[model samples]
Target: MKIKAINGVKDILSDEIVYWQKIEKTARDIFRRFGINEIRLPILEKTELFARSIGEATDIVEKEMYTFVDKGITMRPEITASLLRAYVEHGLQVRQPIQRLFSIGPVFRHERPQKGRQRQFHQVDVEVIGAQEPQVDAELMAMGQMLLNELNLDVSLEINSLGCPECRPDFRKKLIAYLHERHDSLCDDCKRRIEKNPLRVLDCKQQGCRAMVQEAPSIVDNLCSACEEHFAAVRKQLDRLEVSYTLNRFMVRGLDYYNRTTFEFLTTDLGAQAAVAAGGRYDGLVEQLGGPKNTPGIGFAMGMERLCLLMQQQEGQQEEQGGADIFIAALGEQAIAFAAPFVHQLRKLGLQAAMDYSNRSLKAQMKQAGRLKAGFTLIIGEQELEQGRGILRNMDTQEQNEFSLQEGAAMLAEVIAPDKA
Candidate 1:
């Protein structure tokens, strides 16, 4: 029997790695500018962490999590739960009143794959902890916007509030009662949620569930005084920063720990999986995960694969492959001996340089140079090696010139240097 990769997973080959590198570099540069340091959390966590934070009734916790018992400990499906665990156990004790943390790594979800959605996906996550102030929310959103803007991705921001615990209980009761009236019209999952987790009914993506909840009561309308005030402050801060957004009353995050502010950075270009990024305030998450009380926080996570897909679609092109600045083609045994040191000298001067190791003929070496997309080709034949000189051909313009070995290296270095070039 031939073994193959499991379904819903795919390999990232060399040709596609440049796009990933570009996106990660852009994210890292933007995050650094915003004063958010990178934090790496383990891929696995105690399964109970997600159960308490993401909630037992949600799709992620119920159907998608890759949970397993390992030597009496349960492993988790995703990294966000681990992120929260790290923040509470280790980050909280630090003196910093506010911590800005970012992470980029793989997360597992057992969903059927399509287009950009995968069973194993990567996420770029950012979290701001120990700050209940609405400005922190605005700042977090701003950092996301900055990253998108830097990438030149045309995306829209959708904002909502899930009301704090003080008001959500009443809202859940009203929502459940409304769903009970339309119980016969709901899908089986929504029907089950009506009793177990009434709030989840609003998050269903099924056509029938969507239609049934069109007139359902919004959590925004039932916000408690404090929750309403916090939401208002968040909006006011966003307005002051001139961040454009749509008020999406139905945008309840999948996590149960979220409170007050919730958001999703969406793009219609990605088909049904339109959300490129999504997250919210989880003020109660710390306490839920056996840590401090009332430690409010907000953050967001972007699917790197989804972002790359969107970028490819929006740009209508793939990133051009990077190549060496020069290719040294040797013609004979003597030329080969001379070319080795010359190529190393070019590289030491900070120029991308490469030479054929297979000892092919002159014509074949030239062809290989072209295939490598080398900007310039240095032809070191017997005559040139005898004279300590070589022929340089500009691959782009097909212009040929002759120079001594040392002179050619100096000229290439000059072209690469700012002042001399």
Candidate 2:
């Protein structure tokens, strides 16, 4: 039997890897600018960690989690659980207060795949721990906005507060009562949620459930004095920073631990999966994971594959070209021998250089160079090799220039450098 990758998983080929690399590099650079160091958490974590942090009744833990018991250990489906574990087990114990960290890696969920949804997909996550100030939330939001802007994506921010523990229970009680009154009209999933996780009733995507919750009480209206004040402060900070957002009353995320500020960046182009990124303050999450009590934190995670899809759409709009700076073609046996070292030197100088390793004829090498879309083609013939010189032909203009190997390499380097040429 031929084995194949399960559905909802797709391999990223070389042609598409550059898009991810660009996104990763940009995100890393921005995080570094914000003084966030990288933290690589394990792909797997204890099931309880997620059950506690992400919430046991949510779809992630209840329906989507790829949970299994191994050697008396329970493994979970998502990376956020492992991330929280790393924070408590290592970050708090080893690192200083107010740790700012980011992680980008694959997360798993047993879900049906569509255009942007996948069973296994990558997420660029940022977590700011130990900061209770609302400005931390603003900073996280700004960072996310900056990343999307850097990717040239036009997106809208939908922000809301899930209220704090001080108020959430009262709200949950009222919400559950209200949902129970409409229990007959509620979707089956939401009917179950009414008993187990009533807050998620507001997050139900089903049409009937959404309509029921639409008339249901809003958490914003039921927030305690402190949660109300905190929510106002977070909004004030965001406004002060000029981060535009729309207040979404029904924006309670799918997770259980999220509190106070919750947000999602929506784009209309992604079809039914409009949210490319979403997260918020999970102040109780650290404590739930057995960390410090009341360790306030805010963070966000972006679906990388979805971002790449949006990026491809943007690239299509821009109609950009992707190609290397130089292609080196050899004409003879001696030329091949000489060109190999020359190509190496060019690459060592941080230039993208390729040679026809198949030992094809000069005409065939030139054709390959054109197909590779190399900006310039360097030709090394017997005479040119003997003279320690090469012919550099501008692929676009078809204009040729004779230069020594060193000069040709320098010219290629200058052409590749943004500031130099």
Q: Relative to the true structure, how large is the alpha-carbon lDDT of every model?
A: 0.83, 0.83
Candidate 1, which segments miss by more than 4 Å at Cα?
1-3, 72-76, 316-318, 407-411, 415-421
Flag clash pairs in model 1. Answer: none
Best by lDDT: 1
Model 2, runs deviating above 4 Å: 1-3, 72-76, 91-94, 315-322, 386-388, 405-421
**Model 2, range 10-37, lDDT digits (tens) per residue?**
9998778878888998999999899998
Expressed as tens digits, the lDDT of each residue in 1-421 for candidate 1 is 9998889788988878877888899999988888888888776677777777788888887788776756323444555667779877885547687888889998888999899998888889888888899888988897888888888899999999999878999999999999999989999998998978787788888999998898999999999999899889999999998899999998887777788899999999987898999988988887778767777778889999998887788874468678768898988788888788878877777778889867788789888888888988888889997787788888889999876776766676675333433
Candidate 1 has a TM-score of: 0.94
How many clashes does each candidate structure show, in the order listed? 0, 0
Model 1 accuracy (lDDT, Cα): 0.83
Worst 10 residues of 2 by lDDT: 69-78
In order of appearance, the predictions have TM-scores of: 0.94, 0.92
Backbone clash total, candidate 1: 0
